[model samples]
Target: FLIDCFVFFQTFFSSQKKMSTTSTGSRLYESSKAVDEYIQMHYAPQDQLFPYDDQYAPSAGFQFVARTATLCVESFDKFGEIREGETLSALDVGCAVGGSSFELAKKFATVDGFDFSEAFVKTAKKMQLEKKLTYSSLQFGETFEDRVVSLPESLNTEGINFFWGDACSLSANENVSKKGYDVVHASNLLCRLPKPKQFLKDCGEWVVKPGGLLVLVSPYSWLEDYTAKEDWVMGLEGPFEALKAELSEKFELVDRKPFPFLIREHARKFQYGVSDATVWKKKCT
Candidate 1:
């Protein structure tokens, strides 16, 4: 059953970037256009997942993030209660259009979102602004644009910020500042990388303060080797073992749950499952 579950997740949780102007080559432009189309087709819209109405709650990815967040929050609360008037900060690496960041924003006082794609960042900023307006306690039936223009100062209090960044090379002193974040989240990102152990270690240094939290959720492992360009290498045993070994030394394993979710990116009608989540905390020195 364990092996079967691993195989299932290896197929499931595997799920972007852009450049500027001055493109001269026709082939390059055509390829870029095709890639844009592909991203738009698969990427979930902000409104669809985080609508103005409460009825549109819980997208598949959103659900995963929420579940992970809940676990992280619970772990923190269980270990150390979040005192009143004390602000907590969180980092969402590979935030991808800021849906996860926005979700975390609701829980934390400050959230910094990072993504490699400039286009995704732009859309996420727009979404963030929209969310600010919608949830700003405006009167019923008030127009969002009008309310936003009229109450610009009110939008300033929203608890989220975003920036374009690479997670793999994130620095503790340079990028995030030393001992900065209280919680760090990297969901469904590790399996996409060529060397995930290095990535995980980098993440540990980037956001996790002493006694802070680290939560990672990925359906696929990054231990398997790949030969062909077309073949998707889903598991990497070395990287997985390396992460487990490294984190074990620094972090206390708090709560871990095996979540099963449909892999929407793989074009499967039936839900392709994966071993979904793990949450840990940096040991207090």
Candidate 2:
């Protein structure tokens, strides 16, 4: 099961990059398969993520994105990071389908969601404008079931915005948020960048405000197609330890734990993973 999942993910990740201007690439992101996969991951219920009744089936891998998002706000409250009744702006980097972005909107004054896929941005914007989204879930190869996702009443969609941009180069997003944000989220994205170290630097330098939070959740599933070996953030040392060393100069580690995620491949198959989640408080310099 695990091997099949990894192979499927490698193929998916390899085709997910944005193409260069000079070259025309296949539009896989616009395909129904791509959209359906994200919808199920982001909007599907916990039971759907772990529907099996057998005790051996994977559990606690559901609601990965939304849970991590809530983790940021909850951590702030737990540590007294937020002032009394203070409002904050947030950025959701690699926000595929906008679940975490909307989750952030529950507490944040404003949230900006950025992704490399135009289809994801379009779908998220549709949900923003219409307050609902219709998608299909794969039951088997070429077989699907129709589903609709409604915007939760608890979320404030007015202050949320979605954009198509690259995590490695977010100048356009930086323009949208000139001052920086109180919280920056990039779940399962570090290993997907060609230059993960630069992304970490950018978070401290421009993406996150001083004395704010940078929430990262990643499995560190480094692949040559997505990231060069030399650019791996984990490096030769232990994964979290190396990441800790990388950000220690600019950020203070506040919390660390494991977050399990699940991706439904078909009705009977699912890809399960455990991501390391870390919350860092930017130094107020």
Candidate 3:
């Protein structure tokens, strides 16, 4: 059944690609915004920073996040041997509105979420507060209050934290260093930057501790021009190669998979697509 579903989705996505032109800069931005809005409306309901639905449905973004998070958690579990009472820390780079960060928080003892957008950080904080109040299982103790400043006073705690930070630059590393997360997660973030390989290398340096875990997912092949063909790299394979070349000295590839996904609520008729993901473990001396 799963194999059949994968095949059907591959065929559908291929057909959609043939019908559509490669989106350029503004067009790409617009398309991304549309997809983001659609996801926000359908999947994110805690805050309204993004103009979309807030219901918890199976949107494309949600599916992608779910698959990527599963890979990340599985890799971390296998490599780190995480157990209850262990002070496991996690960092979600480019966390957007905190959906993936919240997912991370559920798995680890401490979560530090960061995004370049102030609005995104604010929305993430609001959602974190709401999650604290509504969900008894999510226990964000004092760490949440000390790290996340924008959160409402009513639900301040310590288990989860949010901050404004950029992926391209590791200025956030200073903050991450303080928490010392055992796992670092980057979802579809590296490809969006101007220097994707460098971004990955920086993530390796800042987020993951020795013997920690690094999980990354990206649909775009390279970090060059979004619309132009100049010096462009192909999708997951190219980025994965570059990541390996850059991080091999300090990390070892542990697991890899392709996440089949589709842009839910798209007006266009595309059946399915996929994103490539990799899990690496920091070398332990």
Pick the lDDT winner: 2
> What is candidate 1's local distance difference test score?
0.51
Candidate 3: C-alpha lDDT: 0.54
Model 1 clash pairs? Answer: 9-274, 222-236, 223-235, 223-236, 223-237, 224-235, 224-236
* Steric collisions counted per model: 7, 0, 16
Q: Estimate candidate 3's RMSD in Å.
A: 12.4
What does candidate 3's lDDT look like per residue over 100-168, in tens digits?
665666677678877655545665576766542221111122111111213234533457788876565
Kindly indicate the candidate among 1 and 3 with the higher TM-score: 3
Regions of candidate 1 where Cα sits further than 4 Å from its true position = 1-62, 80-86, 132-157, 172-175, 221-242, 263-271
Q: Model 2: how far is 281 from its true place, Å?
A: 0.5
Candidate rank order under TM-score: 2, 3, 1
Candidate 1 worst ten-residue window by lDDT: 1-10
Candidate 3, 6: how far from true, in Å?
33
Model 2 residue 169 distance off true place after TM-score fit, in angstroms? 1.3
